[model samples]
Each structure stands twice: as structure tokens, then as C-alpha cells.
Target: MENNTQTTIFGLRAIIEAIESGSTINKVYLQKGLRGDIFYQLDKLIKINKITTSMVPVEKLDRLSKNKNHQGAVAQISPIEFHDLEKLIEETTNQNTIPLFLLLDQISDVRNFGAIIRTAECTGVHGIIIQQNGSAPVNAETIKTSAGAAFKVPICKVNHIKDALFLLQAEGIKTVAATEKTEDSVYDIDLNQPLAIIMGSEHRGINPSVLKMVDYKAKLPLLGAIESLNVSVACGVLLYESVRQRL
Candidate 1:
């Protein structure tokens, strides 16, 4: 994610054009003390559309844009539309089949997210939930890693992971946190029920605050000298078990 060239749209007019083109602007960076009619319009548009924006010094913008004629703006352009979590749940539940979802807490690795999305699509998960910030940026690398699954899978970006879990729980879906803190193996869970699987970040497992709210904490058994599995593999394992059970 260092050189986010693929995801960035620079230049003030170009950024504004992106917004007008219905591009999902993840976040916008504006030069501090920047002033102009165009700038004002962009500000007004950002406020009207509720797009995320931050004021940064020109030096920072320059660094991010790699000395391009950015005209004091940089935006992260999203390639796909984010599904509404509530709406997704409603639609999935209305189908009368067991709803399976994947909730990612700080899953910052783009390739890993893509890989999980691929597996989720194969296992027929209803949707994937992630925090609006701190989640991996969907880019070419992610799409490549996913083998194009990123485009097919329903992705829901929420403000807070904990809040998403609460909503899921209230909707009669069991929140399962995959972490080693619990002795309950993934096999112990009844995946046939409405369920949401919580996968954590690469470096850290699920957030402690989120883990407390989860309905069940499940772990995949590790028998080898290694005690940990790649988050993507762990996700696939958790998902396939659900598939295995429902069959």
C-alpha cells in the first residue's frame, strides 16, 4: 500500500471530476490554507456528498502525489460500491437460507482480503463487513489476488467493527470471533445457524473490545510447531467448515 498510485486520483479538478463521475472517494486530502472558487466548490461538494476530507500541508500532498501538479488535492478512488450492512442483512435474511458473513477487524493486507473474498464467494457467504478506515485498500493487487472475486463479493464498509457486530447480533446472527484466546475449536461451533465470522488483522488478532461482544470465540486447531496460520488460510478454513456442515 506504499505507492498507492492505482488508487489515487490527484489534481483538484480531476478529484472533483471523480466525485461527479460517481466514483467512491474513500478520502480526500486538501492543501492547508488552499483558497479559490474551485476550491470552495470542491469543499462544498465534499460537504454535500459527505466525502471524507483532510487538510494537509502542500509538502505532504506533494509527497503523496510524488511531485505531480496535484493542485493541492489527492483522493483515494474506490473501484467498487460498498453495500449497506443493514440492507445486505435484510436481503440475505429474506432469502430464508442460513446467512453467512465475514467480518474483518483491521484486515490491512490487501492480498489477504482479496483471498478471503475469493473463498467467501466460493462458500456462498452473504457479505463481508469491514471498518470504513484501517481496512485494506481495494486495488489492482487485491483484485489480482482475489482472481476477480473482489468485484463479485458483496463488501460492506462500516464505521465501527463493534457496532457492526452488535447489529448483526440483534438481527439474530451469531457473532463468532476467531482468536486463540478461546479453547473452543472452529469445529465446535454450529455453523448451520445464522452466523458472522470475525477475522482479525495480520499482526494482531481480533480487537479485544470487539472480542468481548462476540457471541462465540472459535479457534482452528494448530498441531504443528507453528501456532499461527495465515489469516487468509484461517478464514478459508473457518468458512469451509460451515460449508461442510450445511451439506
Candidate 2:
């Protein structure tokens, strides 16, 4: 997140003011089947602002609003602006350090994504790559979960993760996929160099097709009875291992 703007705004008047005040509204949710003068004004402003919007049920608005009196509409204001991957790479390459990147494979949990971003920022990761469609929305809950680190990290949303992986590969970045199927531990890989690690969703793990394209596949050692670690915790462990190695 790059700005000081609050992550959410509710109420039609407040939303209209947000638009008038030049706030960056990421997505707008309008209650389905609502029609009135105020609603009309908000809709007009939303259209004039060209904001991304969705017509959803009132229950959806209630969920997004956290049961607040939303008055049939809610808007999410993004605190961080998503970066262009190419430009971010160019800038990172110019920094003269081994660029560390994180590629999230279909992670839809907002808190998990935010936790990962917080860890990545703390560990000095250059940027994060997420799928444009399936990735979680960076909302107020995500911001709160990250402890505001979402504003500090650079993130890129790509149409397809493969294309971004190929681009990174062309840049000589070693793509590491974290999976439980691998015999290799995190210690086996030299993460000190420019590299990107693929951390996937808890249920599906990394995409098998993506698994085929990675340069290395590694996993965290599990000595206890638990079958798997939370994706956010696993991401932090991997990032810190790299951090330790680089230091």
C-alpha cells in the first residue's frame, strides 16, 4: 500500500465524497435491485469516475461492510497501487542486488496474502507476482492482517503466471517452487542469488503444470504430526531462510 487513504468507505454520501476528493476506489459493490435518487447520484459518480464495480446481493454488501449500515453500497479504496512487472523488474535490476521475488499461485485468502506480503516486505523481497483473476482482493482485512505492510511491498498482477515465470526465467532468475512432494529442503537451494519462489494455495499447492517449469522444487521440513503448514507461515520461513543466507 502506498497511500494513507482508509481501505473502505460505506454510505452513498461518503462514497460520493470519496470520489469527489480523488480517492482511488479499487472496487465498488452496489446492492442488487436498489434504486433511488441518492443511489442514482452515487451510480452517476461511480460511472463518471470509471471505477470497477460489481452488482451484488445485499448480503454480500453486509459481509464486505462487516454488518455495518452500508445503505446498499460499499466501496474499497486500495492503499497500494499495483505495479507494472516489467518496470518493476527494470528498476530492481538497476539496484545491483540479487532480486528476490515471490510468485503466489492461486492464493485467494485475503489474510494469507496479506501475511505473505508483510513477511516479504520485512525480508526485503523486491516484489510479488499474483494471478490477475484468482488472487485475493487487497481489502481492509488484508491491510489489517499485514499490519500495513501491504502498502510497502510492490505487487504485480499478471494475466497468466506462466508468462511472468517465463519473463523471469529469461532474466536469469531461478524459479523455485515450494511443494511437499520434493525431497529437497530449503537448505539445499542457494537462495542468495536472484530468484523467485512459487508459494501456492494451502489446498491445491502449486499448479502441476507450473511445477514442471520451475528450476527447483523444495519444501519445509515437517518433523511433527501435522501434514502441512499454513501457507503464510511457510512463506515466512522460506523468505527468512533466504534472508539469512544473503546476510
Candidate 3:
């Protein structure tokens, strides 16, 4: 991703312009029940453009905008255009190296996303995979939270996470899901090989559809009553374990 590329669209007119320009928009937040010519125009444009739109409350928009007169709409544009799965696979294969990817299953926290990106880049993960729906929108907060790491990591957004996992399997990359249900810790896995790690959401663990697709399911060993670490922290632990194994 290009760090200098502007990716946020605020206000109704700007968002409309962004959509018409065919920018890779991650998602759109529209004020709930905002009916008018402007909104109808936007709805038409958004539908025709095939952009994902979410009807959010005014308070939600206000929180996202930091009260910056967002005018009831905001669009999260991709900092860099998302690459196709084939492109990512080809690039990895061309390098004659094992492909390493991090799959995020509905991680909604922007801070967690940022932290995970930071860890992923440092660990030499090839790419980060996220679902198009129910995932965090890559907006200004994400960029800020990532501390610019989002620009460094290659992020691929798929329509369905299961499809992405299937593609990874076809590419011969082992799909590993981090879950507390397993007795094995992430440290036990051999990350030196071509592999992808699935990190679940903070609230709900991994999705059922995703859990069923993983080649292996492992957990981080915890002796304390705390039970689990923060999702971002857990990501760091698991990713760094892969790094350690690779080294």
C-alpha cells in the first residue's frame, strides 16, 4: 500500500465523487433512514457501483467522524488497490519462497487490525486476508491505529472468507486457525512451511464456516485464570511464533 495515497472520503459530495471515480472503496456508512434526493442519488450510485453500504446511526457516524461535520456519510477507500488472490499467490511463488498469510475473521476493532498489521509486516507475512463484509473498514482511524503499518502490508479483501481459504489450500498453503478449543499451542506448529493463520474476532471467536475450513486448529497455552489475551496481543504471540519457527 502507498502510504501517501489519500483513502478517506467524507461528506456526501466527496463520497459520491469517490464512487464515480471507481476508487477501491472498502465500505460506506450512511446515516440511517436519511431519505432525500441526495441520498437516493447516492443509493443509486452506490448500487450501480457495487460498493458495500451500511446503514449506521447518526451517533455512529459522529463517532467515526470525530464530530468533523461528516454530513451523514463517509467512505473508506483502500490505501492501495486490493490485489486478487492469484496475484498474491503468483508473487509469492515467483519469489521461490513459502507463502505466509494472515487471515482475519471478522475482526471489527480498528486498533486490533492495526496492531495485527504491524505484527504481520514485521513477521514477514506475505499478505493479510480479510472478508469484505463484517470486517473493519480501512478508514482514517485504521490508518492512524496501524501507525502506518497498513501501507506496508498487502491486504486482500475477499467476498467470502471460505472461498479465500479454499484458494489458499489449492495454493498448498496450510490454513491454521487459532482457537482455545485445542490443546496444542501455536508454538507447536511448524510455520517454516507455506501457511496462513486465522485470527478470530474479539467478541465471537472464529466463524463456524471458517473454523470448518482450517487444516489445523491450535490454541495458545494459558495457565492463568485470565483465560485469553487481547486479540491483538494474541495475534502478536501467534505471528511471532511463526517468525521464530521460520528463523
Candidate 4:
């Protein structure tokens, strides 16, 4: 059944079918102590796909499934299809314009993620890449908060953000991470080249490992006493700077 921003399917068999059919599942809520041949099959599929799962009370599943017999499992399907990173890079590179992409390192808040998508669309970003596990799901709230820009932007889920960095670098795209750790300002960076800008999560800035891999580290100038900007706002400043440089 379709809910606000996600389509949910109950029953172990139904969820297994959904997985086999290539549905992008955001998460699966499993009732504790679920064990059966069908449940095992579903568990294996979820492991192979690395789909997030949560152990929830039966009452929660009851609520999610609207009191239907969920067979101890409920899957929330992603509202938007995800793109393949390598294919997207190849396609973007083939175009005449210089490729511009966004890599989000575990931005977990759905509203913040949606706002970033909205800004990315407005800034002409070719695609957005995020880690599969730690990032926010593109759910109903995200779509609504994005003002429908979630449907327009091509988003790719990677196993690890570093894997994406390697693939993008291999494709001749330079990466720039937005962080307060950098001495360089975003305005000083040359963003007209094929590039991907990395924005870290809200609490912790960019991961140190990711920082080591980036071609450049830059920060938005802070005139106030505040040490950092909100992830979405910082992201907007960085993206618009890229746009201004390219123009």
C-alpha cells in the first residue's frame, strides 16, 4: 500500500518479490524472532542488496501495515528511482558541458537532503551521489520539502562514499570537499572544470578519509562568530559559487 512518501508492502513473500523485481527499498521493518523459509529468503536478499532493516515491535508493524497481516515484515519502497554512478558519470562526460556533480557524505536528515536536491537542481548539478546506508532516504517528506526537485535530480547510491570518489576521479572529475578544516575559500577554487563537490553531514563535517581523497578542500567564508553553517545552507553557497564561476 502507498503511504505519504513511500510505498509499503507487507508479507515476506511480497517483500521478496519486490526485491527480486528490482524495487528500490528504503528499509524493511522486521518483527522480532521472525523465522521461516520465506523470511530466510527475504533476509538473504536484504543482505545481498544491503537494504537497511530495523527490528521493530509487532505493534509498529501493525501500524505500518494498517493492521494487515504483515507476516512479520514490512518494506518501505523508495519513491524515486536511483541512478547508477558510473553510468551517470559517463553520460555526463559525453555531453558538451563540463560535468558538475554533488557527493553527499551521509547527510541523514530527510528535509536537509530534500533542500540540497532542490538547490542542486537550481544550480545545474548533473547528479547527486550518496552513501547507501548512512544517508537519508528520498521519502515523501524529502520530495515535498524539495518542492518536487527530488524527481528531477538524478541520485545515485554507493556502498561507500570513497568508492564513488575513486570512480569519479577515474572519470577525470576533480572532487572538492566543503569543510571548515580548509584554509581555502570556495570563491578561490576553480569550479569551471569537471568537478564534484562533497558536502559533509550536519553534526560532523566531512570524514577525514574523504578529506584525504578530495582534490581540493574549501570553505565558505564565515563573517560571524558561528563556526559552521547548516549543511543545506553551506551546500547552497558552494553550489552557487560553482555556478557563478562557470558562468
lDDT tens readout by residue for model 3, 94-114: 796778899999999888888
Instruction: State the lDDT of candidate 2 residue by residue for 1-247, as single tens digits.
Output: 4656457779899899988987667788999999999999999988776666889999999898999999999998877677889988888878979999999998989999889989999999999998765678777778889888888888887877897899898888899999998899999999999999999886899988999999999999999999999999999999999999999
Judge candidate 3 at residue 10 and give its lDDT: 78
Query: By summed lDDT, which 10 consecutive residues of candidate 1 come out lowest?
Result: 1-10
Off by over 4 Å in 3: 5-14, 36-38, 48-52, 56-72
Q: What C-alpha lDDT values do all the predictions have?
A: 0.88, 0.88, 0.84, 0.92
Model 4 clash count equals 1
Position 240, candidate 4: lDDT: 91
lDDT of 1 at 168: 91
Cα lDDT of model 4 by residue, 1-247, tens digit = 2234678899999999999999999999999988989899999999999999999999999999999999899999998889999999999999999999999999999999999999999999999999989889988899999998888889999999999999999999999999888789888889999999999998887899999999999988889999888999999988998888889
How far residue 14's Cα lies from its native spot in candidate 3, in Å, is: 4.2
TM-scores of all predicted structures: 0.84, 0.78, 0.86, 0.96
Ranking by TM-score: 4, 3, 1, 2
Residues 1-247 of candidate 1 have per-residue lDDT tens digits of 1223247879888988989987778789999999999999899989887776789999989998999999999998877777889999999999979999999998988889889999999999999998877888777778788887877888988878988988898899998989999989889889889999999999988999998898999998999999899999999999999999999
What is the Cα-based lDDT of residue 120 in candidate 2?
92
Off by over 4 Å in 2: 5-55, 62-75
Error of 4 at 134 (Å): 1.0
Give the candidate number with the greatest lDDT: 4
